[model samples]
Target: MVERVTLITGAAAGIGVELARVFSSNGHRLALVDRRGDRLTTLASEIVAAGGTAPILICCDLEHPEACDDIAAALAVEGVEVEFVVNNAGFGLFGYATELDRAEQLGILAVNIVALTDLSLRFSESMIRHRGGILNLGSLAGFLPGPGMAVYYASKAYVLSFSEALRQELAPLGVRVTALCPGSVSSEFQARAGIEPGLEHEILNVSASDVAYAGYRGLMQNKRVVLPGLGIKIVPLLLRLFPRGFILAAIGRIQLRKRR
Candidate 1:
């Protein structure tokens, strides 16, 4: 069991919960951050019941500009320097860019792109000194342009690019950065992203625990990018072999939902 302190965002449910379970089971102390106060408390309690150190519950909306400040302060007061930061607090709005409300689209950028980037940069400096790693939650959307989920795809692209660049910049300093890109995971994410249930009925989704374990192994191995599923690992390479227009059209059709 490792003793390093790990801070995970969006840790109340879905992939976040599984990630917490993985780290906690390995004996790593956690600082779980999420907007759901009740859920956060429940998650922390579950960890304790399972014999892990009581997780520090941080219930705050990442959309709020002051959220990171609060996190930094809370950890400082505890004198806890986080060795691994899972910037997993992100959500997607599945729709055309302009078709979605402007406010909603911007909100996706705020939480998915802005908050993740800010927190990683803020934590990376300390991580360099503490000698640990940072894991950013990216997606298959990052590699392709989604005609329907335009804004969400673009935001993930930003995460992938930012994390990869940071990985190179921080590597020489002994700090590892890895981007975890999983395909069609069985979680709240698809429902919350407005993906149609019938469309999802066709996908054989990977369990959140499987994705979490894959991410943990990749980060420990110091991999720059980890695509969890076999399908996902070949996607980027196969995509490059196709024309951009063809790729975009194919994905756009797949993203379309059947009428009920």
Candidate 2:
């Protein structure tokens, strides 16, 4: 029997990698994408070694809008029909909005916002035709206003809103759309964002496996939003109850302390 395949972006590491593992274990083939070719190759090899099917590695920089089209074409050539898509590739940026470089900020927006949306639109059409599933990685930051990490927060906000809307639009067509919103996860994200490792303990931190597990379950159940931890699950409610000015002030204090 031909194996069903899932396409997962940012699959070289972090939650993306973990999600791939979960899907592969459940008997799905994978088309894993990441900008880091060497890492992607190594991850595929590791999965194969661990008794899972090796994933097809596509090492294209997704920041380029055309990359999604290229990926779609490449998958067609491989004769792989994506039964599921996990749009998990993203990065974080830290520093005051005024102090950050224009190029750097734009890069964050490109990966976190533009690339995610492009891939969702491109894949959602295919999934809808096939009646498949889509799980987009959002962040807890999406629920509340962020102060210092302004662009990253804004990008996640877009993700949350976009995923929710698309979920409703696609539900009648039998395409499952889930927004996986995880809190501070144990990943290289903090290092990339220039956040010190020890500071992670200060917040509610969950494992990549934990987040991936919740995401997988939610996708299968066709949940609209999947916030992994109990603490994070309550955050949306709290954010909604708090005054906007108060929320912003609280976020500002947290960001300021993190910078110190």
lDDT of 2 by residue, 115-222 (tens): 888877877666877799889999998887778889899989999999899888888998998999998987989888886644534456788999999999999998
RMSD of 2: 1.8
TM-score of each prediction:
0.94, 0.94
In model 2, pairs of residues that clash are none
lDDT per residue for candidate 1 within 1-260, as digits (tens), equals 33357999999888999999999998899999999999998888889999999988888999888999999888887778888899888888777777888887888898998889888888776788788889999988899998888888999999999999999999999989999988777778877888764443345356789989999999999999989877668879999899999999988777775212
lDDT of each: 0.86, 0.86
Task: Give candidate 2's whole-model lDDT.
Answer: 0.86
